[model samples]
Target: MLEIKAVTKKFGNDIAVDHLNMVLEPGRVMGLIGQNGAGKTTTFRMILDFIQPTSGSILWNNQPIDLKAKQRIGFLPEERGLYQKITVEEQILYFAELHGMRRSDARQALMEWMKRLDVVGKVTDKVQKLSKGNAQKVQLIASVIFQPEFVILDEPFSGLDPVNMSIMMSEIQRLRDQGAMIIFSSHDMNNVSHISDDLTMLKKGKTVLQGGLKEIRERYGRTKLYIESPLTMSQLRSIPGVTQVTAQENGLLVELADENVGKVIFEKATANGYIPAFSQQPPTLDDIFRMEVAADV
Candidate 1:
């Protein structure tokens, strides 16, 4: 288990992280999210010992994380950093060795990862020779080639297309199945909601929300309704407790002040006959993220 309790960080007088607490258990994935400069990177640095926290403690299995513990952790930075002059094999093996894997084993592991991530180059190819997407894949390979017990990924899906992003998501789930506690940060709410068992949102330097993904969304109530029916926008807005109604290409988005208002909309829409689609759901992760950010403004 990884634990961070009341962790805070400051650079001179500017607080970068404020009294943050988190726990990550084996085989579970936690998604940390925030806008740029929201202190997500600072929290990762503190855990990596790249910088000391201003206060509070970070522990690995109830003991302070030391060099040995550090070796057990894998980290992929937000910024991609692959040496431009080295062979892919040389680059990944170097990292694996530094993390305590033997050269022969790491070499084999590099071959496996190249195939697993669908990296489109030979092991002998120099890092600079690969395309931007393929280079990112190599960097990800280096981070987890040794099969570290805990992994931290910062924007692993940043620049990928839909196909590549799906590939990365599948590999992340595989890692979690192997009992690696994973913590990652991403700006994409869709990716976060798809893979994360738990979610944490940070703003400025403080946590605005943190909890299980389903639990967090449920807390906001089922206030969003999507329907593709003959009901006009004005008709939806006419219902009591309905706050907003907007026409969409295939449906209408109806915002409710009370979840119970869904019953009224349902009855009225179905009074004539069946509608093509009707989905009443709690605020999505995207919705909650926007609400929190907008609240600050």
Candidate 2:
């Protein structure tokens, strides 16, 4: 288990990370999310010992985190850097060796991970030779070549097309299934919702929300209704208890002040024409993020 208790980081007089606490267990993925300058990266640096926390403690399995702990952790930072001149195969081996894996073992793992991640280029291809998305894939391969017990990925889905994003998501899920405690930060709410077992949302260095996805959704209440109809936004907003209406690809997304208002919308929508689909669900992760974080601004 990985535990961070009341951890705080200060740079000069500025507190970059306020008192923050988190626990990550094996086979679980914790999604860290925040706007720019919210201190998500600072928290990851503290966990990796790249920087020291001014207060509180970080422990792995009841011991203070140190070099031994570092060996078991793999990190993919937001600013990706790879040796442009070296072959993808060589770069991965170098990192795996730095983590204490033998050359032969590292090479074997590299081959397997490369195949699993669906990296298209030959292993001999230099980093600069790959496309932007493929290069990102190679960077991801290097981080987990040895299959560390714990991995931290920052913005893993930053610049990928839908197909590439799907590939990366599958690989991350596979690692989690293999009992690697994973903590990752991403701006993409859809990816986070699909992959994370739990979530922590920070704003101005403080945690505003943290919990399992289902628990968080319950706390927000089910106030969103998806209606499949050709109704105009103005028409939808005319209904009683409808707080907001937005255009959607299929139809309209209606937000209600109370979930009980859903029945009223349904009656009106049906009255206009055939209702192909109607779903009353909790606010999406994106909705919750915008609502909570925007309030702080």
Identify the leading candidate in terms of TM-score: 1
Q: Give RMSD (Å) of candidate 2 vs. truth.
A: 2.3
Model 1 C-alpha RMSD to native: 1.3
Indicate the TM-score of model 1. Answer: 0.97
Tens digit of per-residue lDDT, candidate 2, span 1-297:
999999889999988889899999999999999998999999999999889999999999999878877888888989999999999988888998888889999888888877877788988999999888888888888888888999999888888889889988998899999999999999999999999999999998898989998899888777998889666789888887889988777778889898888887777778867879899999999999999888963
Error of model 1, residue 297, in angstroms = 9.3
Pairs of residues clashing in candidate 2: none
Off by over 4 Å in 1: none
* Consecutive 10-residue window with the lowest summed lDDT within model 1: 288-297
Clash count of each predicted structure: 0, 0
- Candidate 1 C-alpha lDDT tens digits along 1-297: 999999999999998999999999999999999999999999999999999999999999999888988998999998889999999999899999999999999999888888878899899999999998899888888899999999999888898888789988998999999999999999999999999999989898899999999999999999999999889999888889999998877999999999999999999999999799999999999999999998962
Misplaced by over 4 Å in model 2 are 228-239, 266-275
Against the correct fold, how does model 2 do in TM-score?
0.91
